[model samples]
Every structure is written in structure tokens, then in C-alpha cells.
Target chain A: MSGHMEITLNGQTKNIPGNASLQALAEQYTKEPTRVVAELDGAIITRDAWSRTILKAGSKVELVSFVGGG
Target chain B: MPPIAHQTAQDSFELGGKIFSSRFLLGTGKFRNKGELKASILSSNARIVTVALRRIDLERHDENILEYIPDGVTLLTNTSGARTADEAIRIARLARASGQGDWIKVEVINDSKYLLPDNEETIKATKALTAEGFIVLPYISPDLYVARRLVEAGATAIMPLGSFIGSNMGLRTREFIQVLINEIRVPMIVDAGIGAPSHACEAMEIGAAAVLVNTAVAIADNPPMMAKAFAQAVEAGRAAYLSGLPAKRPQGEASSPLTGFLFE
Candidate 1:
């Protein structure tokens, strides 16, 4: 049985697997995973638990990537 | 014996009724990692650190950088991306709501390449923030006229850039900075483009009340060592200024008059 959850990545909302870890979700978006950090509900998610964490409905997810220019 | 410290020396400055002990203010960006950043901050002995606000990530367990900073240090939120007065006002309010301090670094970078402040927008924003009960420190060009305008707009202190943001060009606007030191009654903090301890010393020698440095210390090979160097430089500069430098002379003067002994 598959469960669906509503999540907002960055500012866009989408439906995804309820048990999907942040790292798995990130993998679906981009192949380069080192520069990005996941934030769940206004808090920064540590790298160690990005893969095992499950998503919930109406959760706000932001994928912050470090960009260097200046 | 340890060198005699200046009697009137103060580690902290009072702004808007709050006191800050460390004269060196720091920025949170550009560090290689959290550990290095923490170490650098400790070495700098900065009592206040600035951080920018953005959307929070809600997907995984987030690492709050605030948790890493020592509690004694005050957090100064900045509106780095705001280009106009309206946007700056909104960001300032939001930061005050989310952060613990009423102080905001009004950074309106309209031109991304130069990262210079829009003087008109900054003046407008400073007035608005002041009316809203916020201690406004406008990051502005090293122009004495612009600094005077900022003061008229009710800015708590004027943060003049030594060079463009993150450029590491030290004291390019030394002339204007000197003018500011002579004229501005409020504290003059030399912010940005300070790449070394010598640069910081130059600013202090010219009478800058304080200096905010980040990129130089944060991006160095050994950030902690750089921080310590900055700390010593700031102290040395302040001490020199307080000790009263000797007045400049046009020509060498004989300790004993050359003609006095010959006449006898």
C-alpha cells in the first residue's frame, strides 16, 4: 500500500510518497546532493537523517543550496 | 608586566539603550563550515554577529546556525536582498518578529555586481525603521555626505564600506572615511572590504569607532588565527588612538638648540 502526502518544496507544493526521505526526494530533483540541505517546518534538517525521515501532509519543505559567486 | 590598558577603554558600546561588549561585529555568511565559523567567531571576540533570513526548509531536520553561535553574542539580522525602501521595511519587520534583536543592518544592494547600497532607498528605509522603533545601521558607501544624510534620517550608526562587499580591497575610500571620522558624531564602523589586520588598524587609526569584518577571517586558511589577529589589531589601533599620537612636524628639530651652546 502506498500513502500520499502533500508537501511544499521551496515554494511549490506537490504530492509525494508519505514515507519518502528528504534525500530520496532530493534525488528525484537533482543528482548532486552535497550542496543542498533540507528544511522541514522552519527548521534545518541534519544530513544524517535526510534519507530516513518521513513526510507528513501540509509540511513545508525547503531545499536550500549553497551558491558561491561573491 | 602586561601593557597598561587605556583607562577610558570600553569593550562594549551602547546603541538604542542596549550594550554590546565586542567592538568587532561579524557576518555569518562565507564560512567553509559550521565548526570553522564557530572557531573564527570565538577568536574574533565579536559581541554581535549578523545573519540573513530566508525561507526555512521543512523537509528534514534542519541545522540552526543560531544554535552554534555562543549565547553571549547578539544576533543582528540583515535585509541583504532588499532593493527598495518598501522591501527593506518589510524585511526589517519580519526579522524583528523572528529574531531576538530590534537591530537591523539595512543593506539594500540594488546593483548586484558592485553590491553597493542605493543611497536614496537606504535613507528612506532608515527613517522608516527608526520610526518603527528599530536600531538601524545602514550599510552605505564611504561618502561623508551620504553618511550625514543617514544620520539625519535617524540611523543609530553609519556602516561605511571600505570597498565593495566581499571584494577584500582594504580602505579604498580612506579619504572619505577620514572625513566621516572627523564629522560624524555617531559611531563610525568600517564594514566590508577589510581584508587584513593592517586594514583594520588603518581604519581605527583614522578614528573609526569600530569595524565589522567577515570574509577576510572566514575565508582564510586558518580562520581562528585570522580572528585572533583582528582582535589584536583592533586593540592596538584603539590603544594608539587613545594614547594620543604625537603631532606631525614639518622638519626635524634639534633636542638642544644648535646656537645656544656656541654663544656661551
Candidate 2:
């Protein structure tokens, strides 16, 4: 619980402290963490819940944001 | 007294409990850059713009595209990457969580050849998303049964393609769209494959609630100008439809005096 752990963040492996919240992961990975939606194991982690959802080892995270699309 | 046609009524189309007078929905894709996208959208005076969700590059995330959207414009996020109902639902949820509105354009396209929308998956997504309180708009080929099913599934509106996406073919499915215009009760939005302003006009003239255009404007020499043209065309077509087009005749009919004109 005190050592660095790894999880898949947006298809890339990232090493962070054990029990890091999704918000922490987003801050480390995204330019604007406020505008992104984080998904863990294919379930959306709402912005308000980001602080409570902890990323476990081997967790699959997909950080999606709005882009130009037709 | 106001003319009967000009009387106060529901002159605007209502979708997701919002009223929109402009019958043009612009797509915020394929533009040369974000600046052009903003300019074109402003020029079109569209109240709603559609965007797609994408994986944010963790290493070097670009500027947020939402910043390009002007004030007072409603954002419509689309499930462009989803190929199934479940995937579409997931995307829709994430889109809503992004703090953008709950308006989602459901696009379930498993077909790679023509990029046609899968109506079955679209219906499934519509039902699920609508149940979750998201305003759902399902894009599909012009099919009356599918349109009715989408409506029954609680879709905010039915977006029927005029032809292949970005094909510039201009309403190849005219007769089928007319069938939707006739039968479907919900707003019928002509979404993809509109090539020109005339195409938008034609859709509006046939009583479509709106026309969503992207490639035709984005790829034009002057995107802003094209957007303005489309806006004007939509207005003209809506006016024409409202004024009631005259019935067609096989032979030419004389409008001026047939035999009494001084010039004649």
C-alpha cells in the first residue's frame, strides 16, 4: 500500500503510488483533467466519483474526452 | 391581425425539450483546424453541434475541442466509435459525464465498406440511453420500420442518412426519406451524405426537422461561406415548405394571359 504500482492508463502502462485515485491518474495523464471522463473496466467513473475510485493493479483505464466528430 | 401562417405556434422544432428555430445542425469534424470549425459554426448560426469522443493522449493531450464551440451552442456528443449497443451506451455515459449536456447522437456502424449505421444496434442504444435520461438521436438509413422502432425506443429524434457518409451524393435516398417524412411523428433529421446547400434545402423543403452537415462544409474552399450558404438554403427551403409548393403538372401551364398579352 506504500509502494509504486502500475495500471493501464489510456492503453499505456503507468506506474503510480498504490491506491491512487482515478483523479490522480487523470491529473498525471491529461492536460485538462476536469474535461475528461475516466472509465475503469469499461464503466464510466463520473467526475464527482473520480476522487473515490481507486485504480488497482492491472486495472484497465480509458480516459476519453470530446473531440471533433461527425 | 397576424396571418394564419404567421400566427404564434410551434414554429420551431422541439428535441429533448429544447426549441430550435434554425433547421441546420453542424458537425464539428473534418475541419482544417479548430479556428475554422468555430468560424463555420458561427457563420451557420447553428444552435447545436455534434462532436465525437476520443481517447485523450496521455503523453501530450491537445487543447480541448470544446473550447472552440461558441456560447449558447448545445453540444451533441456522438458515439461514432461504437459498433454495438453496449459500446454506444458506454460512450454515451462517458459523454454525459464530461459535463457536456446529455444529448447523444447514437452512431453504431459496423459496416466498413460504406460506413452505414446499424439500425438494430442503434435502436438498442436508444432505448438504453433514453432510459438513463440522455437525449438520444439515432442515425440510420432511411427506413420507415426502423424510424418507428427508434421512436418507440424513446429516441429524441431520428437521423436518417441521405446517402453514404461524406459521399457528396445529395439525397440519393429521396423517396425513402419522403416515406419517413410522411409516416414518422418525431422530428426527422437528415444527417449524412448531404453534398451541397441545395441538398439541405431539399431536405427542409420536404418538411425535415433539420439537416446535419459536415464534410460538405468542412472540405469546401471556404468553410465559413459554405456554412452561411447552408443556413440561407435551410431558411429558403423551410419557407418554401411552409408556403406550400404548387402541385406538379406533366405539361407546361401558361401563367401569363395565354392570348391577350400585348407583347404576344
User: Quick one: best TM-score, which candidate?
Assistant: 2
What is the C-alpha lDDT profile of model 2 across B77-104, one tens digit per residue?
9999898999999888888887888999
Please list all clashing residue pairs in model 2, or write none if there are none: none
Off by over 4 Å in 2: B1-10, B261-264
User: Model 2 Cα displacement at B154 (Å)?
Assistant: 1.2
Q: Best candidate per DockQ, number?
A: 2
TM-score of chain A of each: 0.83, 0.87
For each candidate, the alpha-carbon lDDT, in order, equals: 0.78, 0.89
Candidate 1, CAPRI quality class derived from DockQ: incorrect
TM-score of each: 0.76, 0.94
How many residue pairs of model 2 clash at the backbone? 0
Please give the lDDT score at residue B104 for candidate 2. 94
